[model samples]
Target: MERGNRESLSSSPAAAASASSQAQPQPQPQPQGLFLYHERQRLQLCLLHALNNLFQDKDAFTRADLDTIARQLQLHHPPQQKDHKWWILPLPSLVFKPHHNALTGNYDVNVLIAALEGSTHQKKVIWHDRRTPAASIDLAACHLMGIMLNTSVPRLRGFWTSRHWTALRNIRGVWYNLDSDLPAPQPFRHETHLVSFLDNTVAQGGEIFLIFNQD
Candidate 1:
C-alpha cells in the first residue's frame, strides 16, 4: 500500500504538468491590415466630425459633399513634370500671416472647404491659414488636395513652422510639392521621408511647409 501511494504521488505531478501545458494560452495572430483600415476609416470620420463642428451654423457638409469633392479631385490630374513652371494651382486667396500664438492651428476641414469655395479674386479675404499655424494649414491643404484627387493622405509626423500654406500633388504615384511663392512644383520624396526632413528643418528654426503624400 505504501509503494502504491508513492507511485500515485509521482504520477500526479506528470498529470498536473500535462494539465498545465494544455491550459496554456496560445498567442493570437494580429490583424494588422484590418487594424490599419479601421484606423483610416476612423480618421476620416473624425475629420468629418471636426468639419461638422466648425461649420454647423454655416454651410455644413454631409458625407455626400466630401464624396463629391473626392470624385472631382480624382478626375482633375495636374501636370507632373518637374520643369513645368505653371504647375502651381492659383489659390490667390489662400495667403498666410504670422500669428503671435503658436497654438492657433485650425484642423477643421469644412472651414477649409468653405474658405476655398467662398474665396473671390476681387476680395481676397484673409482666411484661417492667415492666422493659423503653418503646420495646420499645410495639413488641411494636403487633406483637401488628397480628397480632390481621390488619394489617401498618409499619416505625417513633424512639428509646425511659419511657412505659408502649401499643397503637394501625387500624380501617377509621384509627388510634386506646390508653393505659391515658388516658380514651379518641387519634387519631393515619400511622406515619411518628407516629414523627417521637415522635423529636422523645424529643429533648426528653419521654416518649411508640412508635407503630406498619398498612400
Candidate 2:
C-alpha cells in the first residue's frame, strides 16, 4: 500500500480521489443471473466491494484508489499526536487514521461517503439515523439508487470482531442483497420484504446508508 504525497493537509482529499475515481465510468453489464454473481476476490475490502456492488461494476474502484483517499483524509484531519518512548519505533497502526486502517482494510462510513460522493457518478450518501424509524424511509421512492449496510461480525471463533460492508440494490426489477459474504446475490421478494429486512438489521445493531443520485 503506497502512500500518496504526505506533504500538506491544505490540499483537498476529494480532489485527489477525483483524479482517479472520477474518470468517465466505462459502461458496465447488468447482473442477470448466477454468472454475474462470480465477482473478483475482495479480501478485507468490503468497502471497495460494497461500492462496486452498489454501482454494479467490478472495475468501479481499486484498493489503491481508496487507499489514496484514506491517506489524504488522514493527512487533512490527523489524530492527536502523542509522544512515544524514545527507544520505541512507531508502528503503522499507530499512524493509521480513523477513516481507514492502513494494514487491515476496515474502512469506515466516512470513506464510503467520500468515495461515492467524490466519484463522477454523482451519488449522494444519506445516513438513516438510528433514532429515526426505518419504515419512515419510503421504499417506493423513485429516486432511491441503493442501500449500503455496515454489519459487525465476530471472527476467529468469536474471539474478535470486524465490520462488514454489504449492499441492497435493485436488479432486473428485483431487490438483491449484494453481500460479499454470500456465494450468490440473494434477491428480495419485493419492496416490502426489503423494508422489513432493513428494520431487522437495524434492530441487530447494523447501520444503513441510503444512496441516491444528484438531480
Candidate 3:
C-alpha cells in the first residue's frame, strides 16, 4: 500500500479540516439494510487517516517508552520480541508522546460523551475496554487541554513565547513506537444509537445483516 498517495483523499490539513466542517452538520443518517455495511470501509479509511494524524510525533521506538505509553493508554499485550531474545528480532510499532494514547488520547471518552450529550437526549452509553483499569474518563486527556478547551486558538498562539520554546528545546526524550497489526481506530459508534435503530427496524419487520472485515 502507498503512503499519502490518494488523490481522492484530502491532501492538506486544511482540506481535512474542510471535510470535518462539512461532515459535522447534519451527519448523514445511518443507511438501511445492506448499504449500512458498505459504509464500514469508508469509515475505516477515515479512521486510518485520523489515527495517522493522532499518533504522528517525534519519538524513538524503544522498549521503555513503549511500556510507559502502553501503561498510560491501558493497552493490552505490550510489545515483546521473539523468544524473548535481546537484539535478535526487529519489532514494528507506532510511537508517540509519553502522556498520550494513540487511540483517542486521554480525553476521548469524555469528549465523545459530552458531544453526544449535547446533541441528543438519549440514555448515556458507557465505553468499555477490557484492558482499562477503571471504566471512566474525564476531559483532561487532551494534550493541549487548556488551549483547546479554555481559549481560542489565536489567543493561545499569543501565549507561546520564546521562554516556552527554550524550555522545549532543552528537554531530552527518546522516541519509541508500539508494534501492532491492529487496524485504525474507528469512529465512536454509540451503542445506544445502534440498539435504538436496530429495535426500530425490527419493529418494522425490517431485515439486518452484520458484515465485518478483519485484517
Instruction: Please give the lDDT score at residue 143 for candidate 2.
Output: 79
lDDT of 2 at 104: 59
Q: Which stretches of candidate 3 lie over 4 Å from their true place?
A: 1-71, 74-77, 83-91, 95-195, 198-215
Per-candidate clashes come to 2, 0, 9
How many Å off is the CA of 91 in candidate 2?
1.5
Per-model C-alpha lDDT, please? Answer: 0.31, 0.69, 0.24
Candidate 2 on 1-215: residue-level lDDT in tens? 22111112121122212122333222233343222331322446788877777777766777887888888888888878778778876676565557877765778887888888885677888999987877888665677898999988766569988888988887657777777655446677777888888888888899999998787
> How far off is residue 168 in model 1, in Å?
1.8
lDDT of 1 by residue, 127-191 (tens): 33223333443432433332111112223223432222334444445444332222223445566
- Please list the Cα RMSD from the true structure of every candidate, rounded to 1 decimal place: 23.6, 11.6, 20.7
Ranking by TM-score: 2, 1, 3
Worst 10 residues of 1 by lDDT: 1-10
Better candidate number, 1 or 3, judged by lDDT: 1
TM-score of 3: 0.17
Q: Which of candidates 2 and 3 is the stronger one according to lDDT?
A: 2
Ranking of predictions according to lDDT: 2, 1, 3
